[model samples]
Target chain A: DQQVKQNSPSLSVQEGRISILNCDYTNSMFDYFLWYKKYPAEGPTFLISISSIKDKNEDGRFTVFLNKSAKHLSLHIVPSQPGDSAVYFCAASARVVTGANNLFFGTGTRLTVIP
Target chain B: EAGVTQFPSHSVIEKGQTVTLRCDPISGHDNLYWYRRVMGKEIKFLLHFVKESKQDESGMPNNRFLAERTGGTYSTLKVQPAELEDSGVYFCASSPGTSGAGEQYFGPGTRLTVT
Candidate 1:
């Protein structure tokens, strides 16, 4: 079974609006979460991250909210711009797994910010 | 500083052929990881390396796949007698040794297509 899942395969938003992408996980051992953005033909770039201790974290126009109890997280982008269009992936890591600190990623949500 | 980099942005080969993908992590980063995303699937971890030793490879799909990070510098992943299902984008990521939150920087993926 997939440990992390992005139910939305794609999302569209107009410029200057808010874009929210959601992700869910089945493993409770996950304590740290991250969001990565990717453009076509490029590698994923680190966007933002949140630890289980905090419910929310924001970086400029990007914000990430985490609900550990619900095993869910969401990424919010304010005033979404045309350049914000890309694929966003949610990843989680098990806190107890050492040396093997690999991440489990969601399928990804393609965000399109139309001008 | 240079980001993680992957070689041969794209590769196409027939079934039963062998292919080797390479990754170069950022300088001084002690942790390297290998992950892949098949068509219509989430990115899955393959293995992780702490310097020259493999810390975990449980995610490796089968015996045909092999990974090595010799001398703790660069890494290589080889798939022998590849199958059509092995086609996808392979990603490499790295993190600092003391990163407790597990924020990994990813490299542009290498797309592998098995005909």
Candidate 2:
């Protein structure tokens, strides 16, 4: 079963607008969530993250909101630029063992920004 | 410092062949992880290593797959008699902290094609 899911396969946004990508999880044990951006030929790059303790976390133009009660999270990029276009993946992690954590990733959402 | 790196960016081989994918985490980072994305599926965790030890390997698919971190600096994932279903992109990631809270850095990924 897919514990974490990104229902939207793709999204397009005009430049200078806000781009929101959504994700949901079925596992309640997941306490940490992360967002990663990936270009076609490169590995995923960490974007932002939020702990279950906080409802929101922001860095520069990227912001992540978590609704633990709803088992959902979303990533928002304000003034989205052309360079922001890429495949975005949502991942979650819990303390499965001591001194290490494994990540469970979603299918990913492809975001395209138009000029 | 350099980011995580993977060798043999792309590999194509027939079924029943043996293949080994390697990953070199950033210097001084003791945590290493292996993950893969089969076609039409979400990225899934394979295993995790902490300083040359297997901390969590519950994600490994089966006995056909083997992972090793001999010297604690790099890791290798070998699939003997690879099957067609094994064709996918394999990713490696590393983190510096002991907590599950640390952000993991990813490599470019190795694309394995089983014909």
Candidate 3:
């Protein structure tokens, strides 16, 4: 069973525009959400995260928004650059429910920025 | 300051062959995790190790797979008689603290191909 889902397999945006990636979850036990960006040959890198208690979290040009009721979350990148083009994965952890802290990840979405 | 390191970035073996993958976590990180992503599927959790003990192995596929972490440092995952379905990218991640909601850093994945 896939607890987390990213319906969009790919997204394309022009450079300097806004790029938004969306993700959804079926498990209500998930209290923490994270976004990971991966290059072609590299592992997924930690990008941003948000806790269930907060609705939005922003760092530099990246921002993440979480909606507890909708069981949805999104990653927004402003002024998208060519370097930001890569695969983005959405992962969730149920810290309070399971102390093991294993993450459940979605099938990542590949993003391309048109220069 | 080095991130997690994985050995044998790519491997190809017959179905009945045995293969081992290694991962070295960041210094002082007590939480280590293994995850795999088969083609066209989401990244799935394999196991977790805290120090030299096995914290969780519920995600392990079968008895053919074994994981060990000795001296609370590096870890090794071995697959005997690896199956064709085992072809995928394996990722290793580590976090400094016990609560690993958003702090886990990952290494470049190991791609395994069993024909």
Candidate 4:
């Protein structure tokens, strides 16, 4: 079963606009969420994260909003640049419950930025 | 500081062949994890190691796969009598802290193809 899901397989946005990517999870035990950006032929790089206690977290042009009650999270990139075009993956973990701290990841959403 | 490094960026082997992949984590990082992503699927955890100890391996698929971190410096994963279903991109990640609060740094994955 897929605990984390990224419903959208792809997304497109114009440059300097806001790009929003959504993710949902069925597991209520997950308390920590993270987003990773991956370019072709490269590994997924950590972007930003949020804890279940907080509703939102921001880092520069990237912001992640979490709704625990809905078991959903979204990553927003304001003024998205062409460089932001890549595959974005949403991941979650139940850190407190598991000592291994393994992560469960979404299928990933490919983002394309138009100049 | 160097990031996590994976060997054999791409490998193609026939069925019944044995293949071994290696990962070298960042210096001073004690937490190492292995994850795999099959075609069009989400990344799945294979196992996790804290130094030289195996913390959790519940995600390991079968007996054909073996993982080891002998000196706590590097890890290796071996697949014996590879099957077509075992083809995927294998990724290694590492974090610095003992707790699960730190962000994981990933390595360029090794793509394994079983023909």
Could you list the CA RMSD of all candidates, in the order they appear?
1.2, 1.4, 1.0, 0.9
Candidate 3 per-residue C-alpha lDDT over B5-113 given as tens digits, one digit per residue, 9 for 90 to 100: 9999999999999999999999999889999999979999999998988999999999999999999999999999899999999999998875545558999999999
| Tens digits of lDDT, candidate 2, B1-115 | 8999999999999999999999999998889999999986898999999989999999999999999999999999999989999999999999985545667899999999999
- Candidate 2 clashes between residue pairs 3 or more apart in a chain or in different chains: none
For residues A1-115, write the lDDT of model 3, one tens digit per residue. 8999999999999999999999999999998899999998899999999999999999999999999999999999998999999999999998767765888999999999999
The DockQ value obtained for model 3 is: 0.81
Best by DockQ: 1
Look at candidate 1 and tell me the lDDT of residue B80. 99
TM-score of chain B alone in model 3: 0.95
For every model in order, the TM-score on chain A comes to 0.96, 0.96, 0.98, 0.98
Native contact fraction, candidates in order: 0.91, 0.88, 0.86, 0.79
Q: State which candidate, 1 or 3, has the greater TM-score.
A: 3
Write the residue-wise lDDT of candidate 4 on A9-62 in tens digits: 999999999999999999989989999999987889999999898999999999
- C-alpha TM-score for every candidate: 0.97, 0.97, 0.98, 0.98
Candidate with more favorable, higher lDDT: 2 or 4? 4
Docking category for candidate 3? high
Worst ten-residue run, lDDT, model 4 chain B? Answer: B95-104
Off by over 4 Å in 3: B98-101
Comparison by lDDT, 1 against 4, better one: 4
lDDT of every model, 2 decimals? 0.93, 0.92, 0.94, 0.94
Backbone-clash count (model 1): 0
Q: State which candidate, 2 or 3, has the greater TM-score.
A: 3
Off by over 4 Å in 4: none
